[model samples]
Target: METTEWFSEDQATFGDRVAGAREAAHLTQKQLAGKIGVKLTTLRGWEDDLTEPRANKLQMLAGLLGVSMTWLLTGQGEGPTEPTEGEISPGVSDILSQIRELRVQMQDNVKKMGQLERQLRAALKE
Candidate 1:
């Protein structure tokens, strides 16, 4: 499947959508943050899924990036389209796709580990 379709809720997070849209719009992290009136680190956090934007910023991001708020949040509406062949080599695209999938898997593993730790603590207390 194309990288654009990979932004579905089950496959990607809000951060992923944000990053994809920003890239599609040809904006760098710094540029997008500046345009959205946020700090570069704040934008980084959003792209990394470590934090989220406030409503105002979210609105600004959606407007500036030309994507729907719903798509940014749930990946269920209009969002970034697939990059053209001229924009990226097939080999590079494949590598990026693999990297994104691995990132999602790593995030899931971290969540699972955290849950297991909490469960172990509760069991010990009981």
Candidate 2:
């Protein structure tokens, strides 16, 4: 029996699949990077084909991007039928991960904007 390479089902560039799924999910590289516990620059490198995502981040990337584990690594089929927030995509774990990520991003952006507004007001007052 031939041993499988885990992502053997997929044969395309992992970077392409990662970039595709991220786009399909309507997420930015930073968002996807944060979800997978990676740096935004790292995600950029992955998407730009400058470097490949490591084995560990691969599984997490697939989960966050709403794609099959194999497909994310290899280039499997037409890819998995990505489920929405409530649909049956992979498991509750991935969904929860995504939710938490989104919450963090929203909060961060809100705080950043608030700070920016304060700075702008100070500048206008001067």
Cα-based TM-score, every candidate: 0.78, 0.50
Candidate 1 vs. true structure, TM-score: 0.78
Write the residue-wise lDDT of candidate 2 on 1-126 in tens digits: 222222223233667667767877889988888888888999988887789877788777777766777776557654645445454345654664565556557768999999999999999999
Q: Backbone clashes per model, in order?
A: 0, 4
Residue pairs that clash (backbone atoms under 3 angstroms), model 2: 10-74, 10-75, 10-76, 11-75
Give the C-alpha lDDT of model 2: 0.68
Can you tell me which runs of candidate 2 are displaced by over 4 Å?
1-12, 78-126
lDDT of 2 at 95: 61
lDDT of 1 by residue, 10-94 (tens): 8778988999899889999999999888899999999999999999999999999999999999988888776666878778878
Write down the TM-score for model 2: 0.50
What would you estimate as the lDDT of candidate 1? 0.86
C-alpha displacement of 85 in model 1, angstroms?
Answer: 4.2
